[model samples]
Target chain A: MEFQGFRRKDGSVGTRNTIGILSTVVCANEVADDISRHVEGATAFMHQQGCCQTPVDIARVNETLIGLGKNPNLAAVLLVSLGCESTAVGEVAKAISEAGKRVETIVIQEVGGAAKSIAEGTLLVQDMVQEASRLERTSCPVRDLVLGLKCGSSDTTSGLAPNPALGIASDLLIEAGGTSILGEVTEFIGAEHLLALHARDEDVGKQILDLVKRMENRAKSAGQDIRGGQPTGGNIKGGLTTIEEKSLGAIAKAGTAPIQAVYEYGIAPQVKGLVVMDSPGREPEILTGLAAAGCTVIAFTTGRGAPQGFPFVPVIKITGNKVTWDKLRDHMDMDVSSVMEGEETLPDAGKRIFREILQVASGMLTKAEISGYTKAMDIYTVGPVI
Target chain B: MKNDAIMIHEKDNVATALRDIKPNEKVVVGTGDKSSVIQVQQPIPYGHKFAVRDIPGGEDILKYGEVMGRATQDIAGGTHAHIHNIESLRGRGDLER
Candidate 1:
């Protein structure tokens, strides 16, 4: 139940060690991306939220940024600031610095322009990267591992095979006293009761129910029924008849473990075992939420297919359908198609996935990591663009 | 030989067709006494479901041993079971925002 991990000075364990080039606002994304791109051992945290929001919403933005900066995976942080955004860049840097990592800042307005800021940011990133590169991996127990679970572009086979297989793997991880995060509040629409049943207590169950209700109502507030979008055409073509069916399959990623706690979008899990996060099902949003939640790795289950990866975390794409696996072999990391083929059992596949997670945690780059598919990521925002 | 359609649970009335099943193609459900076979009444695409027996409209359509939805129309044995016939019984328009 132990895997190689990087020990952060914050007394937390990290599965990956890298310097993060974090932006204070969307306007500063280019500068952050430039710095991270030009420097090795660095990843950019590009997001599109900073200004024009209510106080409540802006607070959410700040909280998530701080959470991301505090992620143990980041050995050091070089924050790029546009200097006028609502997100507290200084506070974010201070928090990460207090967590015992190298922290530096480059403010565009203060530095005169984006060009000068990027130049400063690049040097800062280079120094942080060099420092991060020297960190070594040590044996860490399963309890230190945090696994983020996500399902996207799902077909019927997702619920039947890979999803269930991942559920088993999730259960294995949780049983080993590790943490597994089940996100995608929208996907829980028709399956909330089932999910609530896994909650540790009645209050936690109510929280699970309320989160599902809130997410559904949020969609409804936009003036449309969620059913119009639930079973994506691909899901129907793949044999899912209703939103209920799709959700039933989607929830399988959490396995049957007790829901230990509930977390909001971007708030990292504070406890061990299976935790649920309030997040959308989209790749960009959920992936960012997972990374902010401090998940060391992502277990992405897909039946149809998904190829996106987060800039810092390693995304391990798993598929249940043989056809999608064959079609997207280069994108997919593990194939649980044999479960449907009756060639392999679910528990066996689950064990194999757990082993793969250990390997990925031990620095064996995932397909998403190897192909450099990380970059198209963003933090989730509930409020409008205005 | 492996079953063409996978029966996920004993209570499931429909089995997922392993491949794109053409009309008149024989679809095997499982092995042993619980197993059954049906003829594909229509073209069932890969990853789609087909009824193992006739299902009356308004009855619960079971999958993974749970109520996935309710059939909106009578579906004959081996007919494709999908949105055209099934109405999601939970949380679509049922919840009050």
Candidate 2:
């Protein structure tokens, strides 16, 4: 299957040709936002973590910035720096430029002030957007598509209907030679063993288990019972009583495909099929990791309704509860409640969802995209602030 | 339609209610050969569970064909199974405590 996509100079295919105004630190966000507001087709990557951290944490921050700049969705990148952060801006710029994209930079201190930096950044962004706009979509194979899977606000219907239906959709994508990423390592706690059985090799299986154990150790270090934090209050209200229960349901989203590889947070998958990304359970942070990993679109399953989207990627929401569908129809993209009604078989529902993914990849805007659901997203870190 | 609540598996003594069931609503259990009707003891929310058979304290409560938690108190047939009556013991507790 082939769809129209923008071809990047770096030999990557982009579903969208966007110019990004990336802020190096939270202090530089206002300037970046101002610059983006002045340029059509420009979006800002604003976050809270570009400074004040340990060396390892700082390097992670640098890697994430470089990853976002290298994302195939971006046609060009403009780095807006505050001139005094700990982030290695030079290294990030070098990496993006080496990836074959036009990279521009501006420092607030060097440019005299926020107003001056915004002016310089806006001019750079406008020129980039004009170039980005000139790029035409060309035929790209389905294998070029990378899909990110996420779920939040889970309910009883999630385990029984929605997540499993998503699994079917995932299987279809993998069969078509497309890549699907199952993230949120924290949610894979009790279900890691089940997923490990599908790994490509024994070593990969061990790595999958290792990621799960690492997450458990993090929770244990915090000295809180993981169950107390497992099914949030919302899950309990929606009939989920424990993390084990949630994990069983969550694993259903991975489908039956063999696990191809395991990747660190915000790192692109090395092999084609279904891959796991080591990430936190928080939706915003995990979504940030996914976007940095170069995912062009996100398929999110929810039973209790979540109206959140990252800055650049389109989030397609699916639900299996007729109640949530009716209540959040504006925010939701597809309804698999028919699964519960037995009106649609699992494969039939998966086909419908796969069709929707194709349409979104070809530029059919999602409800989140249309309603401006671009708020909850930030880089995750393991160190203290300042 | 009366047996909308399903056991999920043979080990489960509680069944998940498919719809909002009001107190005193008529409900039937099991297949045609041995099915029986009983009145709902209280209003059960959609997706919540109700006892299909008698359950004693410390016994595991099953849902989605797996153990969800343990019963904190005895529950008679048709009684709602929830936090008030069940204890969730699935993950590690805070070390600080």
Candidate 3:
């Protein structure tokens, strides 16, 4: 299978060819945002990181920024940095340039102030946007696609309908020699055992189990139950009784593909097929993590309607709740509620979703993208901000 | 007409109501060869679960043919089964010693 995409020099295929105005620290966000806001073909990645207490988190911020810059969706990148921040701005720009993308840097402190920084950044972004506009879509095989799977605002129908349907779509993509990433380690509590059964080897299976154990311990260390926050109020009101139930349902999005490998937060996968990335289930963190992992497109299944998208990668919103489909039509991209009605089989629904994915990959804008509802983004860090 | 409820797996003792079902309503759960009719004992809201068979207290509640949690109290067949009567067995820090 093939879709029209922007073929990057690094051999990655981009569904959207846009310039990225990335902020290296929280202090440079306004400047980066202003730069992207003034450019038509530019998007900004603003996050609250780069300066913090721990060396671990600062390193993570630098690595994540490099990954984000390497993403094929960005034809070129302009990094906004605060000169005093701990983020390795030079290394990040060098790494992205090494990935075969044009990269420029603007230091807020060195530029004399925010106003001057934005002015300089805007001109840089405008040039990048012009460079990006010259790239035309070309036919790219499905194998070049890296798909990210996520489910949120779940209800009971999630397990039975959209999730399983998405699972089928994931399976189809994998069968086509594409890659799909499954994150949300916290949602694997009771179902980790079942998921481990799909691992490529004993070591991979053990890794999956360890991720779940570590995620559970993080909550337990805080002297609280994970269930207190998981299976959120909307999930409960939508008929999910326990986190176990939600986990069982959520794993359905992974489909039946073999788990090839596991990766840390924001790390790109080395192997194809279905892989696991360590990330929480929150929209902001997970979406950013997926984007950093080099995913050009994301499939988000929501039973109660989640509207967030990434600035560059197009997030396709799908749902299985008919009521949510009717009420939140503006947010949803596809509906597989017919699976619940028994009018459409799982495989048929899966095929339909697969087609939608191909269309979106070929440059069709998702509702979230069209509505510009994609600003809630953040980098996941283990340490507290200083 | 659409089935009133759905049983994901044959081993599942609970069925999810496809629509709002009222007390004493004879809800047809599942579809085709895998379906059965049960007299609902209480109002089951849309998307909520109801015990398709009687479940004893502290017994495992099955869904998608896996243990989702344990019932807090004996739940009669055809009645609602939810957080009020079911508790997750995993990730419970309060249970840690």
List interface RMSDs for the candidates, in order. 2.9, 2.7, 1.3
lDDT of 3 by residue, A172-200 (tens): 99999999999999899889999999999
| Model 2: share of real contacts kept | 0.46
Q: For model 2 chain A, give the 10-residue run with minimal summed lDDT.
A: A220-229
For candidate 3 chain B, the 10 contiguous residues with the lowest summed lDDT are B27-36
Error of 3 at A15 (Å): 0.7
TM-score of 2: 0.93
Please tell me what DockQ candidate 1 reaches.
0.51
Query: In candidate 3, which residue ranges exceed 4 Å CA deviation?
Result: none
- Using TM-score, rank the candidates from best to worst: 3, 1, 2
- Model 1, position A170: C-alpha lDDT score: 92
TM of chain B, each: 0.88, 0.78, 0.94
lDDT of 2 at A106: 99
Candidate 3 chain A: worst 10 consecutive residues by lDDT?
A: A219-228
lDDT of 1 at A354: 92
Highest DockQ scorer: 3
